[model samples]
Target: MTDKTIRHIGAPASGRSTRERLNPARLLSWVSGYETLVLLGVLIVVFTLTSDRFLTADNLQNVALVQAVTATMTLAVLMPLIIGEFDLSVGYLIGFLVMLEAVVAQHTSNPGIIIAAGPVVGLLVGLVNGLLTVYFKISSFIATLGVGILLSGATQGISNGKVIFENIPSSVTTLASEDFLGLSLAVWLTLLLAVVLFYVLEHTPFGRFWYAIGGSERVAYLAGVRTNRMRMTAFAAAGLIVGFAANFALAQAGSANPGYGPELLLPAYAAAFLGVATYRPGYYNVLGALVAIILLAIGFNGLSLLGVPFWVQPIFNGSVLIIAVLVARQETRQVRTG
Candidate 1:
């Protein structure tokens, strides 16, 4: 038979063949995966139903501003995730960066470029993390967790257990307060970064290499991909983004506290993991992370408006992360087995 005839012959059996062929499996892989679309739909339905206040201009403005820090950090997390590594240091790293910026702004004569220092410090920290994980052959989780502990101690020692209330440079402040059109500066920055990250993850050679390595390090290495370098680079990139998030958050609060970083850790991680469950269900990607962040932010924000207690936020974040990850795992397993 001709190749074309063979292709037709291999098609699924008749009743609703077209629709069945487009079953959850095919659709999931193409549309990122079912998890992502389901999350998107859920967000839309919740917003539409719960509070007319949920989708209003002001509330959306709030959502963008509120989730900016988490979203930025989520992008940072995306790289390591794609390469199948996890960096628990992001939360503590942001905390340290925020505190460092505040302290530097107060003591240094050159507070003008102090915000820029955030990313520089991040790069350095990321280098340390990468080296430990890649060169020493330490597990990424162990290395990052150790680094996180060190950072927490360093931050506390530096501040002498005091909250940093220094008057940061005006430039930093503008990042939080300034508006671009109708959105806050942070929101605009988040959107810009998201676009850049999405392009890199979807279209760039580096992104393809990262994903390849993530799918199977051994296989990717056999195919001539530099697994170690890819993993290291992913961690470093995550650190830089975490630094940006730290600076943005510090400016938003106009103060730096040692505790700020850990507060964001759960939500940041939750968002990143949840992203893996959606769009691409079994895989991690930038757009999936962004969508996860948005959905979590909407649910949390909506609950807050409905007079939910302060402690409820953690409950919501934790529960959603666990559930999303579980669902993602199940779907992924079925895909692999069937």
Candidate 2:
């Protein structure tokens, strides 16, 4: 072949080399590393345009308040995810803890004791989950699922399928009504936890160890990382976070409802998985989870304002979870291939 024809055969007719067209930077730019953030921005803009109340201060505050519980749970789930484990019982744990708090509140007027019970129960649940999965050789998914079922039954038994409507301590009510800088205390607490968790997950050796374990438990073990301990710690941290979430839930509702906990499960997982596409792309991060929670809260609030049916919220959450999983898998594969 002629030299010109040979060159033509190697290069596109558009005068671009194959390598130039397939450049990683170009591909990544098109994919956008911050897909979740971009989606969130788009949703915000759309909602703002569609609903006059969407951007109002009251509405925004309400979104923050409503999402606080989910955000806390998302943080809990994120820890377990970092260590390559799932805590399916978080939603049920919230129910169990809230019921436990309410039952305690009925008997005691001291808010300190009532509040202190949350973390204790959370730690115990975490310990059980960790031992079951790490030591007993059960899969986290199945172990937590079984644990969650037990929690559900316990919650029903504690509350007797009745919502606690009275004897709620004043402190608990104050937590729900008290506002700081125009936001509810629960919202502020969620933000505070997010900040603390972000720092720990991104800047500490403990966090890195969990990430290492998540990436490859075998490799982490060979490298002298305490894989089992880290995994167990992740579960424990998750349980502790869930305990806090229960406290927030009780404060916000001023009552304990046996059925409310399971409703949070799908949304919490959705937020955590959706977060995988933000900030860190393939890895779970607190900032991403927080952003995801905000996005979901806004989306649901906007829809409700537009008179959408209640069932639609779960549909949206489930769809987001599926999409997030696909995006996370794609990102991970890209990282491996690259």
Predictions in order: lDDT = 0.79, 0.83
lDDT of 2 by residue, 1-338 (tens): 00110011133347878887788766555544466677778878888888898889888877777777888988999999988889999989999999999999999999988988988899889989999999999999999999999999999999999999789897987876899998888888888999999878778888888888988899989989988888889999999999889889889889998887888887788888888877776778887788788777777888888888899987876777678768766766665575
Q: Give every collision pair in model 1.
A: 28-33, 32-279, 32-280, 33-279, 35-278, 36-278, 36-279
lDDT of 1 by residue, 1-338 (tens): 00110011244456666777777765544443445567657776776687778768888788777777888888887778888888889889999999889888887736556787788899889888999999999999999999999999999988889987866777787888898887778888888998998778777888888888888899989989888888888888988998889778877888888787877776776778888776556678677788888878777788887778999977877777888889778767765675
Worst 10-residue lDDT window for candidate 2 reads 1-10
C-alpha RMSD in Å of predicted model 1 compared with the true structure: 5.1
TM-score per candidate, chains pooled: 0.85, 0.88
| Error of model 2, residue 108, in angstroms | 1.3
Q: With candidate 2 superimposed using the best TM-score fit, by how many Å does residue 11's alpha carbon deviate from the native?
A: 26
Any residue pairs clashing in model 2, and if so which?
A: none
